[model samples]
Target: MKVILVNPPIYDFSAYDVWIKPLGLLYLSNILKTHNIEVVFLDCLDRSYFETLVVKPDGTGKLPSTIVDKPNILKDIPLKYKRYGINKEIIKNFFLENNDADYLIISCSMTYWYLGIREILDIAKETLKQTKILLGGIYPTLVPKHAYLTFTNKVDYIFVSSNFSELFAYIGLDAKNLNFTNFPAPDYSHYKNLYYIVTRFSYGCHYNCSYCACRKIFPKYTAKTVEQFVNEVYTLYNQTKCKNFVFYDDELLNFTTTKQLFYEFLKLNLPIKFFTPNGLNPRFINKEIAKLMYELNFTDPRLSLEFTSDFTHDITDKKITFKEFEIAVENLINAGYKPHQISVYLLAGLPYETLNDVFHSLELLSKYYVRIRLCELSPVPKTQLYYQLGLDDTVDPLLHNNSIFIFNGVPGKVKPWCSYEELQLLKKFVKDYNESLKQKTIHSYAHY
Candidate 1:
């Protein structure tokens, strides 16, 4: 049977590619190839399709988009919402040309982009009406109810598994023995054109922050062996001559794993640049790790300091301390990294958080001479906040959108302490603060 795998577009206020690839869908394509099933990969968000791409040298790029009408619920955001990706004609033309697929699988990410998913599903209904459609990935897993609400009538199934599970079995493969060793390396050769490569050295995360959905998506923390990592890196570089790589792991700069991975990295020393787009934990950075990162050509290292002070200890679950952040920044500086070479992520727009709190945090962070990234909270489903407020993704996926959520707070419980104008000012302050500090800036790298 012929299978078509799709990576849908993003409908948001702003979207940029920080080495974001449909890694799962790519892996699934190879798995289908291994099983001798004919696979057709379609990416609605293809960056290379447009003539003028905002792609940087490090594999990150800005998505091509058109300003879309704002959702009724999100009209007060004061920013233009967008449908970021290739145009509708491109999606329709692809399906129109190749409408013979037996099964169509779509991968979902960012719960708030549910509308994008629906748009693609609607296209599938119009063109590939005879074929079955399956939805999987973050959105379907975290917000199954919402997924069903939006897609139940248009699509045939919602996949909530971390693994292929019944998907492989349904495709007539022996699912019981499927593992990574036997799995084919993700096939990106089919992309419209070349960009940089993205790989994962680890899966899941060790810490379970109140704001994170890592535990639900990836229950266990798993790291690749040195040999596995080195071999994969060499294989990709040799095949594609792509030196830019973004590590997709939730956590990789930890003490124990860094020691092991660095030794192998030093030996291989493939002529490649590395990026830690998935914000590194400040507490994990030490002198040795910092030195190794610099030597290994790690660029755009961002420290994840969710909150500036212990005031949000209950909300952040005390992941890291201010003292720890200070040490990490110091270590990076001491290890030959300029203050501007690193960036720190601080959370803003949380429930019950005052603009005064963010201002004070900014004051303290600015003293360090490092770039500051103000992460507007996009309260995800299945996290502590979601449960605390009794919200599922079904409440209207648009509500989960950070672009809108940044302006409005939870419907009834509490509104953001800052007004829409105040929020804009805070965001502007962050942009200006980072602009003011020019410590060997290595381009902006966002983790999510």
Candidate 2:
């Protein structure tokens, strides 16, 4: 059997390549190869697809994009809608060339980016008329009914289950026979030029925050042994000689195994840098762990501090407290990390949250030396906040987009918490506050 796995382009107001790779699709590729099924992978968002783009030293860069017309739903938004990836003609030509595949599988990430999947489905249906096409990933998994209705005739099937048992059954295979204990690392060999690799030490989160979808996607928390995690990292590093590694774990420091993993990493003594794009739980960071992370060359560490107000504790499940956050910052700074090098993520535009609440959080964060990242909330389907707002499955997924959600909340369902102007002012406040700290650091250095 032959299968073509595709990572579709993202259609959004803005997009960047921050060590983003199709890790799930690559893992599926390895599984297919184990069954002797031939796999052909195409990543539309691959940086190597466009040779003219520049990449930074840490493997983070911009993607090649072309401005496209916005959908009628988003027409009022001032930002230019863009298709960030290889051109449509390139995708069409590739499908035409490889039309003989028996099955075509496409992966989707953000629910708001389904337009890219629709485009890929249209092209696939036109070129590979005889092949069966399947769509699966975060989008479809979260809103299966909407996905099925949206692409009713375009896709042959939609895989909603995380275990891939339904997919195996449809393809005439028994998933129960496969052993997951020896699951292979994602097949990064498909990429022409690899820069950084993304891996996870754990599978899911133990806490179920109302705004998060991690619990919905991964119902149970599971982790790989420290030995297994370290061995996989060593193997990938030896193979690609890639020095940058990013952890996609929702809770990188929540478990005891994480400490062992860090010690193992330190023992390697390899000149590699680590990053955590997903913010870490501040409650887990201690003096010892902070020291270990600093020794291991972890860069740009970000802590998850969703809110400062006590009333917001119910929504965040009280995962972190102000005292814990302060202690974590002090530990990191004492471990030799400058305050400006640390970052704290503060969420904005949440339902029932006033602009004063956000501003208060920002003002509190300004007291610290760390930088602040104000994240606008995107109402994900099936999350507790989504249901609390009375948003049903019938609502268009486009309404969940963070870019326009702040300015224009669901027309009749929810009112805008803050206007675009207010959001801009809040951003400026953070920028100026961070800049003040930077100048202070410079002056202190000169004085010393």
Candidate 3:
């Protein structure tokens, strides 16, 4: 059997390279390959696309994009609507040339980026009239109802997870005798041209924050053993010669896992750089772990400090407490990391959170480190926050875009902590703080 895997493009006002990869699809690709099925990969967001634009000093760059008409639901928004990928003409040509596929599996990412899936599906249906297509990933897993409404009549099947037993049954494969005693790792051989790769050693978060939908989608908290991680990395580096690896774990620093992973990484002694893009829970950091991180060449120590004080933070769940956050800063500094070398993630534009709350959090963190990464709250389906706000699947997914929260909340329906003008002031404050830090001292830390 021959199959095709596709990573759809994204449509938004702004997008960035978070060292993103279709990890879920890669695992599924591995399963098909092990069954002796021919697999073809077409990654819309692949970094090596020749037409990619806005290349940056960092390995990450932008995809080739074109401005398009805004979705009917989002027409009034002032921001320009753009599609970040090859144009429809090029996409159609691709479909025409690569029409020899029996099954096509399309993967999705954020719920807000669902338009990309709709666009790709249109072309795939027209060019490959007899091909059967399936949809799976974050968008579908989190909001299956919406996925059904949009794609029920278009696609052959919609899978909530990678349960190949059901998927094989649909494809008429008698895999009843095939034993999945051990699943395979993500297949990245097709993406060998990437400069930086994303690696996830863990599956889900053990801690359930009310605002997060991780546990709902993942169902269980599973992790690969230390040996498994080391073996994957060793092979990846040798195959792609790509040294930059960003960990995409939702909770890599919970309990002793981060420290254990560090020891295993050190044993490899390979000339590679590691990073944790999903900010680490500061509560897990200690002198021992910090020292090991520096020795092992882990750059970009991002601390997850959602709010400044206990009162302002979500009290229902557990993460980095304010006290633990301070301890982590102290440990990182004493371990020889410079002030500018460390960064903190602060959440802004919460539904009821005030500018004062954000300012207070920023003040507590600014003294310790000069850089802060601000994240806007984008309520998603299946999260407590969404149900708390009475958000339904009927709502347009584009409203969940983080950038939209900067201007207004839910198209002027829900009230944010601060107004648009207030947000501008906050942005200015951050820019000034970062500028002053640059003038004061240069934190020359080796990254890479």
Candidate 4:
């Protein structure tokens, strides 16, 4: 049986090289390949792949994109809109040229990128009428109702999890008790020109942070064994000869399983550098863990201190506070982590957040002498915040963009209080703080 997995184009006004990858889809592809099924991938957002194909000017393929149209909602801003992959025609041609697949699986990321998913599904339907098109990933998981009501008529099936065994059964493949036993690592060989390797040592978060959707999406925090994780790391390093690694785990520092796993990794002392693009829970960082991380050769540490809201943070996730956060930072510093080596993530523009609150958070973090990475709050479906606010369908998904704090729109004794100008000023303050940190020093410590 043949399986074609496609990562649809992104329609956002701005994008970044944030070590993002459709890991779920890639994992599924690897599993299918292990069972002797034909697996193919078409990543639309990869610039290297796009350049190699040489996509044309008219959103068609053969060269890299030059004229990117600004997204509809974000057109008011001064940024170029882009369809970040190969040309639509090239994608179409690739589909038609080798279109003998029995099943076509498409994976989506951000919920706001649904338009791109619809476009890809439409093209798939046109190219191969006989094949069954399945949709999965974050979009389908968070908004199943929207997926069923809207795309049910369009796609044959929608799966939220990486459980593709049921689909395999329909195609006469025996997929019972498919244990992680001998589970294959992700297949990145097809996209050889890729720069970084994005992998997950664990799945989901134990803490239910109000602003995070990790719990809703991956309710159970499951992790691979240390041996399994290290084996994959070895294979990836050996095969790709790439030293850079990015962990996409939601809770890589849960102290229970992940910490122990990292301890084992530090023993290896491989000449490889590791990074965590997703922020780590501050509570898990103790002197021992910090020393282990340093010994393991972690080049940069990404610490997450969303806000100094104290125990009220428990309202969202019963995790994090100024006390524990400071202890973690101190331990990191004691273990030889320079202030600049640590990147702290601060959440700005919360639903009812005040400018004073954000300013204070920045000031507090800057006092630690660490570089602050400001992230806007992007509301995901099924989160407490999303349901509590009673978000409507009319709400532009772009408004959920973290860059602009749309929730803080009302000003005072009003129903939906916050001014756009006020929110902009807050965002500017965070940006200015980040820029200033590059030039200023708040603390000093030895580097790993």
Candidate 5:
């Protein structure tokens, strides 16, 4: 049997590769390959292999563009919209040359990225009309019903959960003994070396943070054994020899099972640096964990502090108190992490958040000598915040971009949403804050 996995084009206003790689689909490809199944990938986002490349303005890399039918909902958006990937003819020709795909798998990200998803499905239906289509990833997992409703007839099946083993069962493959260690390592060599590896050491989180979809998406919490994860890490390190590694686990500091793994990594004392692109759980870290991370040289650590005030305790996870957060920062600082090395992700634009709230959070993070990573709130479906916002389904999904902060309109305006002026001010404030920190860092270094 032949399987083709695809990461469809991103149709957003701006996108960066940002160490992004679809490990889930590639891992499945490895499994299929191990079972003697021919696996192929049509990575539409891959700039190197794509035929019709559009040189990005910033010049970091190129993005492919293909003229396809735009979704009806986004027709009014005044943007020169083109699917960022090789054109239809090129994709079809590539498929013909590499033909014989019995099954086709695609990965989806942001819930609002369905435009790209729809385009890929239409192409697959037209080109590989008989092949089975399976779609899974963050979007589908969070809003399975929305996906089913939207792509009901367009695609063959949708996998809501992240368990690849269950997918094997759906396709009648025996994967009873499949474990994390047995899972195929991502086929990163197939694409350009991006110098970063995204490895999920744990499956789920123990805490049911109301605003978090981690528990809902991955109901069962399990971490790969220390030996298994470290071995894979060492193997990938030897193979790609990439120095930077990113952890995608919702909770990287697994207090119970995975602490030993991190502890062991500290003992090994590898020189390779580590990163947590997805912020770490502040409540899980202590002096020991902080010391271990410092020893392992975890650069650019981001601690998730959804809100600094206790007012959000009910709606958000109130696991770590303000004092606890300070202590955690102090521990990292004592362990030799520079102030610039630490950052905190504050969900800035929740539906009812005020400018004062945003200002206060910034002040708190600044006091800890940590930079702030501001994320505009995007109320995903199934999460409590989504229902609280009462988002109109009729609204364009493009508006769902966190950059827009659609839910958090103004305080007392007729629209009852964040005003354009207010949003602009918030953006400016964050910009000024970051610039101030950068200038301060330079001045301090000069004095040193």
Candidate 6:
């Protein structure tokens, strides 16, 4: 049987390539290939079209996008809405060329970017009437009822289960016969050019942060053995010659095998630059791990210090204390990393969090020489914060966009915690504070 896998375009106010890939879909493709099923992969957000767009050495870059009309719910927002990816004409031409596939599976990422799925569905229905279309991924899995109701007639089926049982059954394969543990690495051969590889050592997070959906999406914490992970990375690096490798694990350092995994990576002695885009837990970063990460060339390591105040403890589950953060910073700096090269992610615009809370966190962070990466909270469905606020599934997912949610809030559901101007001021404060740090040449040991 022939199957087509598609990674839909993103419809958002702003979008950038931070070593993003359809990892789950690529794994599914590998499974299908193992079962001797023919697969055709199409990534709508492929960055190859924009030849002039400058991509960094680490493979992060901007996507080629075009302005589009905002939805009625977002019309009042001042930002321009964009369809960030290849043009629809390319999708149409692709379907016209290969219309004989028995099944077409479309994967989604953010819930707020569901419009991209709708766009792809329209094109698929018009071009391939015989193909059975299926929608899956974060959008449908998080809010299955809404996804089913929205695309009731458009899609033939919606795969919402966490495992591939339902999908295997639909495709006439038994789940018990497939080897879930030994699946091959994600298939990146479909793309003409490879930039970076995004992989995961673990599946889920042990900590249930109120604002995070990691536990909700992946209820159990599971990890690959050190050998399994190291071998995969080594093989992929040799195969693609891609120097940049990113870890998408929700909890990279918290895993039991993490330290050994890093030791194994260090032994490879390759010139690969590693990254942890999903910020690491500072509490787990001891001196040994910090030194290992430095020797392994971990670029701009970001620590998760969502808030510094005690009031936000319940929201963050008291993940890391300020003392722990200070130690992590000191450890990295002592291990040959400059304080300015380290970054901390401070979450802003949380429920019940005031501007003063954010300002205080920034004030405390200013004492350190690290860079600040401010993150705006986007309430995800079924997360602790979502249910705590008494939000139902009826709320439009588009309102969950962090860009406007921090400023406009949810219409008639929730009021804005901070106005647009206040958010801008906070951003400027962070910028100025980070700039001030860059000018200072204080010794790391002296500061401690």
User: For model 5, which pairs clash?
Assistant: 64-85, 408-418, 409-417, 409-418, 410-417, 410-418
Q: How much lDDT does each candidate structure score?
A: 0.80, 0.85, 0.77, 0.71, 0.70, 0.86
Ranking by lDDT: 6, 2, 1, 3, 4, 5
Please give the lDDT score for candidate 5.
0.70
After superposition, the stretches of candidate 4 with alpha carbons farther than 4 Å from their true spots are 50-81, 169-172, 179-182, 392-399, 404-420, 441-448
What 10-residue stretch in candidate 6 is worst by lDDT? Answer: 439-448
Task: Candidate 3: count the clashes.
Answer: 0
Candidate 5, residue 257: Cα displacement in angstroms equals 3.6
Clashing pairs in 2: none
- Report the lDDT tens digits of candidate 4 across residue range 64-151: 4445565555655444555555668867886886589988888888877777787788788779877888888888777777777778
Per-residue alpha-carbon lDDT of candidate 6 for residues 1-448, written as tens digits (9 for 90 to 100): 9899999999999999988899988889988998899999899888876678888998999999899999999999988999999988999999887799999999898889899999999999899989999888888888888898899899999998555778888878868854435667888878877888888887888898888888877778877788988999999899899999999988999755898899899889988999998999999999999999999999989999888866676545768888888999999999999888999999888876788878877777877778989998898998878887677799989998988888888888888888888888888887777777767733222122
Clash count for each candidate, listed in order shown:
0, 0, 0, 12, 6, 0
Q: Lowest summed lDDT over 10 consecutive residues: which window, candidate 1?
A: 439-448
**Candidate 6 accuracy as TM-score:** 0.96
Candidate number that wins on TM-score, 4 or 6: 6
**Alpha-carbon RMSD, candidate 5:** 4.8
lDDT by residue (tens digit), candidate 3, 293-371: 7888778788888888776565645676788888888888889888788888888866556777777666667767547
- What clash pairs does model 6 have? none
* Per-residue lDDT over 1-448 for candidate 5, one digit per residue giving the tens place of the 0 to 100 score: 8888888878764566655668788787778888898888877766666434443322235464545554564454444555676566666765666556888888887877777787788777667866888888887887777788888788778888777776787777897977664675666766663446778787787777666677777788777777878888888888877777778787878566656888777766666878787788777678888888888888878888778876675457766677667888888998898876788888766655676677767765665567778777765667766556665344445556564444333213213245556656666666666677766631221111
RMSD of each: 3.7, 3.4, 4.1, 5.6, 4.8, 3.1
TM-score of each: 0.93, 0.95, 0.92, 0.87, 0.86, 0.96
User: Cα miss at 179, model 2 (Å)?
Assistant: 7.0
Local accuracy of candidate 2 as per-residue lDDT tens digits, 324-432: 9899999999999998899899889887578877877777777687888878899998889888878889878888898878888888887877888888777777777
